[model samples]
Target chain A: MRQINGQPVTTTNSQTRERILEAAEAVFGDNGYHDAIVDAIGRRTSLSKGGLYFHFPSKERLFFAVLDRLADRLVSKAEEAAAGDGPALDRAEQALRAVLTALSRKRRLARLLMVQGYSMGNQFERKRAEIFDRFAAVIEGRLREAVLNGEMVEADPALTARIWLGAVNELVIHWLHAGGPSPAQRADEVAVVLMGGVRAPMPVPMPAELAR
Target chain B: MRQINGQPVTTTNSQTRERILEAAEAVFGDNGYHDAIVDAIGRRTSLSKGGLYFHFPSKERLFFAVLDRLADRLVSKAEEAAAGDGPALDRAEQALRAVLTALSRKRRLARLLMVQGYSMGNQFERKRAEIFDRFAAVIEGRLREAVLNGEMVEADPALTARIWLGAVNELVIHWLHAGGPSPAQRADEVAVVLMGGVRAPMPVPMPAELAR
Candidate 1:
C-alpha cells in the first residue's frame, strides 16, 4: 500500500475521499462555487484540513471533482437504460427517464452541474458543453437506430438529437423552477410532447366519394 | 433645453444617451459584468467619463439598463407577432420567429441577456426570470385562446408556455453554438418539431371499417 504521512494508504483513504466529495457536493450546491470552502467540506467529513487537501488540492479542483462524479453517474445510468432491449425510441425514453430520476434524487448536484457550473468560466463552459455533447451523441445513436428500425421518421439524427437534448434540458430546468411533477411524470410528459408534439390531431382523410 | 455642467443639453443629449447605451451593450456583452468598466464604454462612445456618468450612474444601473432595453425590444416584437390576426399556433410560431430574428440581429445582446445575465447573481437572475415570465405569459395567453378556439388541445397554458419558451431558448443557444442555419429556418424547424413532434405518423384508419 502507498504510504502518506507515515501511514499506509488503505480503503479508509478511499472512503474518506468519497465522504469529502459528498460533503463538497452539498456545500457547493448550497453556497455555490464562490462561497464554498475546503474547511466547510472538511467539517462535514471525518477528515481534517490535511486529509481533505490530500484528496483535493483546492476548491476549484474539488468542485470539478464533484461535477465529474455527478456527470459519470448520470452518463452511466443513461447508458444502461439506452442499452436495454426495446424499440429505439423506447430505449431513448428510458434513458431520459433514468437520467431525470437520478437528477431528481440529487437536485443539488443537478443545480451545480447544470446551472452554476456553466457560469464559472470558459473552462467550465467547455466541460458543460462536452457533457451535453455526450448526451447528444447517445441520443443520436439511438435515433439512428430508430430510423433504421422504422420506429421513427427519417431526419438528421444529429440535429434531431440535439433538439431533443435541448428539450430535455429545458424540461429539467422548468421542473427545478416550478417543483410540482415528479421526475417520472415529467419524463412521461416530456417524452409524449417531444415525440408527438403539441399540434392538434390531424383529421383522418374521408373516403374519396365522401370527399367529392 | 436642459443644461448640465454649464452646457446646453439638446437633442444631442438624447443621442449621447443612446450612444452610451450602444457602447455599454458591446462592452458588457464582450467583457461581462465584472470585467466591463465604464471607462471602456466611454472610450467607445467618444464621451468623457463625466459624460458617461451623466447618462448612467453606476455599472449595475448601466448593465440593467442594457438588459431592460433588450428585453423590452424582444417583448414588444413577440407581442406584435402574437397579436396578429392568425390562428394561435401560427401566431405563436410567428412570435417565436420574430424573437429569433431580433436575437440573431443582436447576438451580442443575446449572449449578455441569456448567458451572462443569468449568472450575475440573484438580482440579474430574478430579472432574467421575470423576462422569461413575460414571454411565457404572452405564449400562455395565445395558448388559452387556441384552446378556446379549438385550435389546440386543452392543457395548462402556463406550463405549456414555459416549456415552449424553454425549447426556444435551447434552440437559440444551440444556434449560437453551431452557427449554420438562419434563425428563420431554425425557427421553422423548431415550430414544426415542437408543434408536430418527432414521432412516426400514425396509420390512417380505413373508411370501410369505420362505416361498418
Candidate 2:
C-alpha cells in the first residue's frame, strides 16, 4: 500500500526506524509488551524482520523507541504550555488538561505507556523514569511560580507533581478500561478534587429562633 | 506434608481451595502473573495438578482467587480505618494511609493486579469494577462524615472518592516498581498536595525589610 503522503516512503535507515517505532506502538498497545511480537510490528510496515533489526537491535529497543516518541510529544506539549502566560495554577491546569486529553485521545498508546511502560527492564525503565521526572519538573516549576504568587500553601514541588500526575493517570486508566463515563467528565471530576481537595468547609444551619 | 494446624488442610474442599489460593499468591508474587505456572503453585504444597485443578479449575481462576484475597484484606483494612474513632479529617487521612501502606506491602500482588486485574475479560472486569466501587464507597463514607463535621468542604463524595483512589493507586504502582523513598514519605507528600494543591503562597518580607 502507498504511504499516507502518497509519495514512495523510504523504508531504509531512519525512515525504516520511524515506521518500525510507529508500528511497535500500535502492536504494543494492542497486545501489550510481553504478548507483542517484533515480527508483527515489522509486518505492519514494508520492512522485513532483517530490515527492522537493522534499526532496532531487539524487541525491547523497538518498544523503547515507541515510548520515546510518545514522551517527546508530551515533553514538547509541556514546554509549550509552560511558556504561555497566565496564573501559575491556571497554566498548570491547562498543561495537565492538555496532556490528559491528548493521552485520552491516544487511548492505546497511553495505556501502553502507563500500564506496560515499566515492564521493559532497567534501560527502558531508566529512560521512562527520566521522562517521568521531566514531566514532574514542569509541574514543579509552575507550582513554584504559584507559591511565589500566593496562590497555594507551602509544599514540595516534586511531591505535588507526583500527586497531580498520579491522580490524572489513575483517572485516565479508569476512563479507558471501564465503559461507565467519558474521559472529559472523569477529567473534570478529578480536576475538582485536585484543585479544591475534599476539605471544603460545610455550612452551619441557622437556628429558627434567630430569625428576625 | 501435614497441615499447619492439624486441620487436614488439603483434605477438605474449602481448606484445599484456600491452600491453592495461598500458593498461587506466593507463586504469582514471585514470578508475576504471566510467568507463574500452575505446577509451581501446586508444588508449594502436597497437591498434584489434578488435585489443584479440582479446586481452582484453571490458572486464571487461581489468579482471581489471589486477587479476591487481597481485595478482602484491603476492604477489611478500609473498614477498620474508617470505623476508627477520631476527628473526621484525621480518620480520613488515617484510612488513606492504611490502604496505601497495605498496597505497598503487597507490592508483588499489586503488580499482578495491575497487569491482569482488569484484563480478565468482561465478566472479571465487572467484578473489578464492583470491588473498585466498594473501596470508593468506604472513602465516600469518610468524606461524608468530614463534610458533616465541618472538617472538609461539601462536595460530591463519589467523585472525590474516585479522584483520591486514582491518585493512591498510581502512587502504589510507583512505590512498587521504583522501590525508592518510603511509602510513608510518599503518602505524606501526596496528602499535602491533595489538601493544599500545587500552589504555595509567597513569603512576606520582614518588618525590618519594610522599614528599609
Candidate 3:
C-alpha cells in the first residue's frame, strides 16, 4: 500500500468511494432518485457533504453510479445462469429467469432501477437505455450462438434479444407499478412465448390457410 | 351552432382548440417538450399566449393533450386493423404492423410521442404508461378471444399483450435513438416471434431435456 501523509492513499480512497456507493444505493433506493438526498448519503457513510461531492459531483451522477453497480451484479447473475445449461435456448431462458427472479426478490432495487429514474429527467433515461443495452448484449450473444448452432431458425438474434429484454422490462415494470404476477412466476410462460419465436421451425403442418 | 353574440360559440372555440393542438404538436415534435416554447405554438396558431392558456393550462397539460390526441388517432388505426380480420392472431399481427408502420412513416410524431417526453419529468412517464395500457388493451382483447377459440394454447393474454407491446416499444425507440432497420421493415419478423408465443402448441417433440 502506497502511503501518503502516513495513510494508505489508493486503498483508502477506493474504500471510501465504495462505502459512499453502498450508502447511496440505500438512500436512493429508499427515497428514489429525486427524493434521495446527497446529505443523507453522507450521513450514512459518516462522511461530510464535501467528501461525498468529491467522489460524486451531483445527485444524478450518484444515482447513475448506483444503477451501474446494480446492473453489474444483475448482469453477472444472468451470465452465470446462461453459462452452464443443457441447450442454448434453455440457458437463455434461465438467464431471463435469473433476472426476473432477482428483481422480483428485490422490489426496492427493481423500483429504483426501473421506475424511480424517470423523475431524474432525460439524462437518467439515457442511463437507463445504456444499462438496457448491456443486458441486451448478454442475451444477444447467447441467442446468436443458438442461431449459429441451428437450434433456432429464421430469427434475427439481435432483434430477438431486444424483444426478450423488452418483454422482461415491461413485465417487471408492470409488476412494480401495478400488482400482478411477479416476473419470476411468469418467467417460464414468458420464456416459452419468446423462445417459441426463435426456436426451430415446427415440423408439424400448420392449418393450410393459417400457415404463412 | 349556438351563437355567442354574433359568433358561433362551440364551433369556433373547439376549432381554435384543435388549431392550437395541431401547432403545439408540431412545435413539440420539432423542438421537443423542453425546448418548445408556448409562444411558438401560439404563433403557429395565430393565438395569444392568453388564448392558448384559455384552452390548455400549461405546457405539460398541452403536451398530455397532444399525446392523447395522437394516442386517439393511433389507437383508432390499431383497432381498425384488428377488427374485421380472419384469425384473431392474424388481426393481432395486422394491428402490430399498423402501429410500427404508422410510427415508421411519421418519425416526427414518433419522436414526440415516444422519446421527447422523457425530459418533462415523472408526469410524462405516467402518461406514457397510460398510453401503453391503451395499446395493450387492444392487443389483449384479441388475444383473449383467440385463447377462448382454441387458436392459441396455455398463454396469459394480458401478459402476452405486454410482451408484444414491449417488443414494439423497444424496437421503435431503438429506431428513433440509434440508427437501425426501421420497425416497419422488421414488422414481419417481430410479429412472427411475438405471435408465435401465443400460437397453439405444435405436436412436435422437443429435445427430451427441454420438454419442460
Query: Evaluated with DockQ, which candidate comes out highest?
Result: 1
TM-score of each model, in listed order: 0.81, 0.78, 0.83
Off by over 4 Å in 1: A1-13, A37-39, A42-54, A198-212, B1-17, B45-58, B198-212
Q: How accurate locally, in lDDT, is each candidate? A: 0.72, 0.69, 0.82
> Which ten contiguous residues of candidate 3 chain B have the minimum total lDDT?
B203-212
Task: State which candidate has the highest TM-score.
Answer: 3
Error of 2 at B99 (Å): 0.5
lDDT of 2 by residue, B127-148 (tens): 5666777888888888788778
Model 3 stretches with alpha carbons more than 4 Å out: A1-11, A26-48, A201-212, B1-11, B26-49, B118-120, B201-212
Candidate 2 lDDT tens digits, A1-212: 44656886645567766777778888887776766777798789766889788877888777777887888898788768777778787777777777777777777867776766544432344665677777878887888887787776566666667777776666666666765565555666566668653222233233332332
* Superposed Cα deviation of residue A57, candidate 2 (Å): 2.0
lDDT of 3 by residue, A1-212 (tens): 75657975564778888999899888877666666778899889877898898888888788888899999999999999899757787788788889989999998788777767755644565787889898888888888888878888778888998898888877887777677779898877888788877788646544442332
Give Cα distance to truth, residue B66, candidate 3, Å: 1.6
True-vs-predicted CA distance for residue A161, candidate 1, Å? 2.5
Measured by lDDT, the strongest candidate is 3
Error of 2 at B40 (Å): 2.5
Give the lowest summed-lDDT range of ten residues in model 1 chain B.
Answer: B195-204
Give the winner by DockQ: 1 or 3.
1
CAPRI rating of model 2 = incorrect
